[model samples]
Target: MTIGVALIVGDTLRRRWHTDSPGTRGQEFPLLAAREQAARSTAADSTLASQLTLPEKPSIAVLPFQNMSGDPEQDYFADGIVEEITTALSRFPSLFVIARNSSFTYKGKSVDIKQVGRELGVRYVLEGGIRKAANQVRVTAQLIDAATGVHIWADRFEGELADIFRLQDDMSQRAVGAITPMVEHAEIERMKRKPTHRFDAYDFYLKGLASLNLQGSKDAADEALQMFYRAIDLDSGFASAYGNAAFCFVRRLVNAWMEDPKKEIVEAERLATRAVQYGSDDPVALTSGGFTLARLLGELEIGEQHLHRALELSPSYALAWTHRAWIRVFQGRPDEALPDLNRAMRLNPRDPLMPGYFSVMGMAHFVAGRYEEAASWCEKAIQVQPKFLPPLRTAAASYALAGNLQAAQTMMSSLMQLDPRRRISTLRELYPLQRNRDWELLTEGLRRAGLPD
Candidate 1:
């Protein structure tokens, strides 16, 4: 059997790259579209400020299966196997499965399993190859501990191609059953580390999400907005992209990164409206759209409704809890919001956005007039993500209200350096605090820090 060089393109869909040399194996390159590759590569390069903590739940990603048959046509079958397994694993709420789009980006690349674990922030990696001969197919898979490079399980399944779908399902179930107990047992001895595998719209959305999650600088935020826009271009009905794009605008507004707040707000409203309209069934989209409305557009009533619907759809959705907590703060119910925020942190203990969660927790404390506690939580958030703006501002306000003028001024300077335009006068307009007392307290603290009125 002679194997030649092959180039693989796309995630779920596979295309063959023919080489001039037919008999010898040549180096393989993932031939994803140029623009998509650029965006993904750029997103990957963004300096991660801190190592992301491993999720409390067992997180895993199934890499694209190798086409061992040496036939380009068999690439589709291998991809299908991974896709089916990933989807099957996602049904378990306890298992954090990296979405397919993010995972598939590693296809055709020779990556170290440990590095793959760090890049994706997953504790376990599942890798395998597929071989097809005549009417029969053989699938081999192994699960590895990314942190230690230890093999937890390995197995092979063989069946006729006519039963391909059933074979895939059976293989998935077997793999899941084997992994579940191992993960649960390993939970006691270990703690740590995950990415996605998938299509044009989804791939673009994942890239956009990655950019947004970095939240390192204003440029990253702008890039995320553009990526989400591209995702929407690829699929006009991609509600999650719209939701995320709207959330990007909200991020810009809060961070004081926007050059034109009014224009961005209008854009945010439009995107949020579209997300709510088209993604009624998607809990993540609904929650993001709802947060944009309530926090940025000040549409509390409608936002609350969307958030409630989102929670109904996904009771354990950590992000929905985060959004709902914000709404609770707006309604002048900080006490209620704090517990909800805590729940979010518990659900995703090692979430990349934990800093945001901590900062919001400080906001809840601030609203409740617990200035000292607020400052403590804000400082904790700042220690994790020094570049993040909200926590800095919250720290300043909390310090000021607690009568620590020097610390307050230092925090204020940090916030000003991050976004020079923020001031006491600006806070009233941009911040959505429905209670007059809440607004007054925030401004008074900022004014005490010597911000211009």
Candidate 2:
């Protein structure tokens, strides 16, 4: 089975790149436009940090770097650098790093450092700028103590385009060391490891990340998959790209967007396996690949092991925690899932994928027979993403189980309008709930809510 799946994925990848080159796609669909749309959406929904409490460990937010290159097109480069720095810092279990989505909300704005700290619930803020002229680049960064408005550390790095990756590593190390001097030298060395030797592949991966951050939209997900595939074509060892490509399929499964479910599942599983194999030390790859395995392929134990490895690698990775929480829910351990969900929410309160966290929370509650609470969380998820199917299905089932026939029917009506083909009989295939009782509960609730057999 594994060899057959590998051959299928290998053929599909070859055909895809043979017909489509990265150059033409970039011209047809500008990455900048996609990034701008995502930025606007992120800024609009950036309200998760209202009077937040400080974490127990040292916390910091890396704000969007200013583009000093005198070209608006350089915004992506600057933003990508900040995101890389943020990700590198997040690997440390002792540092509480604000997610890129939350920190980038302050882009192109002149803000007081103290206010940024208060809004992000961090003790420190790292702000920087990038200037690229000819084949050379200059970068400057300052670490500020947000509470006292004091500059703790500041530095500048200058290097050629070829040395850009080294410059980024230096900046990440400097920022991490300045914020938490207690971080081990080994951890700093781990942050210095480059994702890819090819700059083009890294660029494509960054573009893919921008598209993935948009979430919810099928078009965005497709674009992200294409970008990741392009990256993989340039650098086959790029595990993060492979992992994210698999996650695009996971999104399709959740939203009922797969045209050929069986084929897509095989492809997703293949991509996920490659991600895990190549990215044994990468948290993003492990988290995405593990979640895809659990949700799409029903490899619950293997997926949980991958997720556990991801958390062990980067305890601050909110998505890993969220994925692990869902895995617990699928394993019929709702009690074990809730705390992980809460921890994820606290780590990255402004994550764009909060609706997903909410939906999984609803599932956990539903599995635990807390019908009213499940309905509430699923309703919140629906409000954020009205067309999302899982939350809508769970909301209907929860309301029906709670004996609110009118609410249950209303939710079912909305769900059916979104995906008319969905039936109670398909629940098992659609959801990988482990326990027989949980399956029966969902089927009964859906039946009560007027779903067809």
Every candidate's CA RMSD:
12.5, 4.0
For model 2, the run of ten residues with the poorest summed lDDT: 1-10
Residue-level lDDT of model 1, residues 1-453, one tens digit each, is 111323222221122212222122222333434554454344333423223466787778788899999888556557755755665455455676665555776889997999878776778899999898887888888888999999988888888765555555556555555656553533211111011112445555655655565554555666566666666766777787888888987887777666656756776888899899988866667888998999887888789899988766555566778888988887789999988886665444334445677788898999999999999988866765676788888888889999999999998888778777666767754678888999888888888987876
Candidate 2, 72-127: lDDT as tens digits: 76776788888888878888888998878768767888999998788778999999
TM-score of 1: 0.64
- Cα-lDDT of candidate 1: 0.69
- The CA lDDT at 225 in model 1 is 67
Clash counts for the predictions, in order: 17, 0
TM-score versus the correct structure, for each prediction: 0.64, 0.89
